[model samples]
Target chain A: MQKMMQQVVCTVDVVLLTLQDSALKVALLKRGRAPFKDVQALPGGYIHPDTDADTRDAALRMLAQKTAIQPPYLEQLATFSGPARDPRGWSISVVYYALVPFDVIGQAGQADVTLASVDKLPRLSFDHRAIVNTAVQRLRGKSQYSSLPCYLAGEAFTLPQLQRIYEALMGEALNKVSFRRKMVEMDMLEAIAGEFSAAGAHRPAQLYRLKPELRDQLTLIARGL
Target chain B: MQKMMQQVVCTVDVVLLTLQDSALKVALLKRGRAPFKDVQALPGGYIHPDTDADTRDAALRMLAQKTAIQPPYLEQLATFSGPARDPRGWSISVVYYALVPFDVIGQAGQADVTLASVDKLPRLSFDHRAIVNTAVQRLRGKSQYSSLPCYLAGEAFTLPQLQRIYEALMGEALNKVSFRRKMVEMDMLEAIAGEFSAAGAHRPAQLYRLKPELRDQLTLIARGL
Candidate 1:
């Protein structure tokens, strides 16, 4: 069964996400070369053998180089590969999804980048639309059990804001009492001592962040909603 | 930015699993060439451009050729790639995991193949030991919410047998009533008409298979245990 090993091009693509205008948006950059030149695509690049320590490192580097974003929740979503995906030759892409809150988006000041809503997006180059769909599904599914939804609300947020982000992701309004109880059961959040948020024309709300032990860890909640 | 893309050697590795002596075990094949000759490793090979359709197809082909296994559950685990993972040169492995019942393993009659237990494994060549650990964790984690544990039990198995398989994979004893209740909530099982399994010195237990619609799909359970 000896055969010459086929050479395939490898790339890492990042689905950098942020919440803006109460909806999830993906960061896209313009292609500068042939094969769908000038089209908006996910932030991506070829794996650098000399610099990248691993695939995840390559994903992080690509996200930082393209969008100037270092999100708090970066995860390997899945790998997409096939013969006809690229015209040059057989190619494979290791896709990662990164989640960030609105403040990170504002800090980046990506005026030229296309920050399109996940639901309504323009035609993207390559298999990026499919990749985006898969990442969205993974994010929504994991938001129920893990400490994933908190990443979308930023570091210090009120319960009401976190609830709104969860509702936006799950596409359903949950009862306020039931939602609060569920959050309590998850035990992923902790009050920031006596810190509070300034809400104009509304009562100041207590600020909470993820438990210190769970900031970068993924733990399953016993009772998922 | 003008540098040429790195040329990385790509391959597919599979963690093929089946039950042996009431524990989860992975199939390993002996390597015939240098760079770790005669070392028992995961069933894997270089991607073939003229033959393999994609990473998954290459993994399937490797498992079939090495162990004679066509698993009921097969999925892409993760891409384990970097320089120094392989001794030959710059290499990347697209790792996948496959699950089959005991009957398939018995049918293969692999005298030279080694079925290593997931809990206690000998030193494996390359990064296969780490890959096996990752696959085992993923299987155990997903078994709580998906129709994954059923794949460990053969088709049309009794409830007790299925529960035993679940306990083996999860490494815990589950309450019988609670487990049954969770299975009922899943609604992914169907009783085989007029069929029963012969239990020694006891009444024949009813045989059930996954529902027709869920035989090939991974459906989420309402409550994960």
Candidate 2:
């Protein structure tokens, strides 16, 4: 006698994050079908056989398939499963979050894309608003103790630029002296011995690069740190 | 003309947490059929109309159906969707974490059910182990800033008992004075207005209960504050 076996279905969704015009933006693709036809949503799809690749790889693949942007950083965000979430049938979705440098994503200028502030956004399809809220909250909370904000920046940037990113995401201005002091204490930044003087700025501010070793260490520590 | 539709499968897996033997434990159920037949895994099932009321409801329903544990606290954890994650086809699973008070799950023992720890665990089916790991990490991290740990304790508990739960989840010993100070500062605890004596212990310590109103406020503040 064979035991009764139940078949389950799975899919992947992504919350793509990038900065535009000094505002944090999330990528939302317009769905073209019923249930949520023509509604804006995070880019995602069925996990393909090729999805055997690492989790990030799967997210990147799905993003690329749906949109023209290739994100640099991707992390597992959270999963959403409810019987009626999808009108089709029993479906569970593992949601991943991708953080791309604003410049990289903006270069594409995809017509269907729109950059919106995290606070004010359009109605999303299928509990995506909740997923994005959770991801943003996690990103903000983790950025306080980790170098996550750096992931949103390019390879090299001025301290002030980095500070602005943190301030924007945190929605508060941090005291310059105190913020830099804390960063120095963390030992996650390496002075680049260079300065940025683009766009006729007042003074050339000192630049720093995230230490690769420290970044990796922080990733491990961020789990429990 | 009808729009091209994409069909994908979804599922819901749950990490039901309970306190047993003064340690954190998770509920695992045995699979009755292949892909990892007879192996223990988190209680979950396909999200179907007859089976699951909705995506969020699936986890709770699965828990009740499989383990008969209706946990009070259930939150969506993450979604896992990788093409090859399932042998059958492309699948995505929305994983949920449920914090069941020790007393609520104690009833499961009456039904001859077992809850296991991460250390002494049986073989689990599929990416369920990875799902459990992610849930545990999130629980540990959130417990620090939220009153989640209190949910695992009895209605009333000693400060030391509460602290031990934190240490066990975090796998680290916190400074007693500092920990107590932080808890008091949060104003999330209230002395039971009396003291209780313990057997084979030094001195009787005052018991405290989580202030419900304060805890709800803290949850909000922790998200934005």
Candidate 3:
């Protein structure tokens, strides 16, 4: 019993996601050590009880260390565990998924991390493929009624740009009128006063940003888009 | 690093919830060992990687062993971990929440376990109070647009009985028309042929059961009740 009890392995993994070129992408880093060395996977590390405050702090630290990007929106996704998942004995990985704007990834100037489309992901280390799929499913599911897509849309955007973001995540074109109505019902966005999108052949559209209080939180509608 | 890695405590906790007397209640058991012995908390145990297939298996074993009740619906909630949450050492608990009918609890008839109303919970060990609150919030949130409430209603029930269960969880009186419409949109329930509620002051209503295939799955609607 003592031997088995002491064999439990604990770690935290972060699935840092972003939207790039109208497709969802995830940041991956090649493992430096064995058990899948040089293979790309989610940014993760062991929990340092001596210094880390909690699993969230450990996740944030690992993300910054590996990818050089701090996500604007982050939430606990789920935990994946078993004896067979890790080459080492029984293991538990407390997984978290974060959303960052495409520009944020670019600004990080991380040459070590690779941005891969979620749909066409390569063979990833451990059970990372499944983790990425779960995050994608959650993002798509929450996009129906929550202001989660706004994180991928960046700090400020026009109604048309936000609509395209939502449509891309949901995999379907939405009725513009109903989409706008649902957005209003969520009440999590505010017009950026005196700011508008650059004028093209058509007239400029008013810009909007998530409510200051709701930047770190999600606002959900009673119904979906 | 080796010592800290070996010191991580891994465990599984189950939040077994049921609707009793129109109120949500959680099953709790008193600890038998040190570090808060005799204090009531959620049923949990160490993950036995040698025998248990996964954390979910550990959760089910703990629930059955401690409370003698196996829930019909079980879902992973989230992982709670930190250095302070446990006195023994840095710990990781892969928490799962389960839904069972009130009659299921009665059938188990375990005197060692106590069913406490979630609204008026007593002092619990570890971070169990917060765990129960998270499970309750999840139950109430999913009840808005999924067939999750059906598990609390038992194997078969009339529409009105089901609606009452939904109202109990949501803490709101839903419009009859919209509620029924949303149920139909979910398409997860099927009427039990020739089954009806006993005639009382009001006429008997048709009895329905979650579709056989959906017994272990949830059917979701785009919009809420």
Q: lDDT (CA) for every model shown?
A: 0.84, 0.71, 0.89
Please, what are the lDDT tens digits per residue for candidate 2 over residues B1-225? 111112234567899887776577888777788877878888887666455556677777788888787665677786676556676555566788888677887667645356888666677788887888888888887776667777777678898998888777777888999778777766778898866747365888888987867442334213211
Error of 1 at A59 (Å): 0.9
How high is the lDDT of residue B83 in model 1? Answer: 83
What TM-score is obtained by chain A of candidate 1?
0.94
TM of chain B, each: 0.94, 0.83, 0.97
lDDT, residue B75, candidate 2:
79
For candidate 1, write residues A1-225 as lDDT tens digits.
222333476889999887786788998888998778998899897888787888999998987777788888889999888888777667789999999887887888876567899999888889999999999999889877767878888889999998898888888897899888888988888999999999899999999999888877776666576
Q: Give each candidate's fraction of reference contacts reproduced.
A: 0.53, 0.38, 0.66
The DockQ score of candidate 3 comes to 0.71
Candidate No. with top DockQ = 3
Off by over 4 Å in 2: A1-11, A29-39, A46-58, A81-93, A122-132, A193-201, A213-225, B1-9, B83-86, B101-103, B110-112, B194-202, B213-225
TM-score of 3: 0.97
Worst 10 residues of 2 chain B by lDDT: B1-10
lDDT of 2 by residue, A29-108 (tens): 88988779999888886555433454456677778777677765677876665556776654556788878788777677
When sorted by DockQ, best at the front, the candidate numbers are 3, 1, 2
- Candidate number that wins on TM-score, 1 or 2: 1
- Could you arrange the candidates by TM-score from highest to lowest? 3, 1, 2
TM-score of chain A, model number 3? 0.97
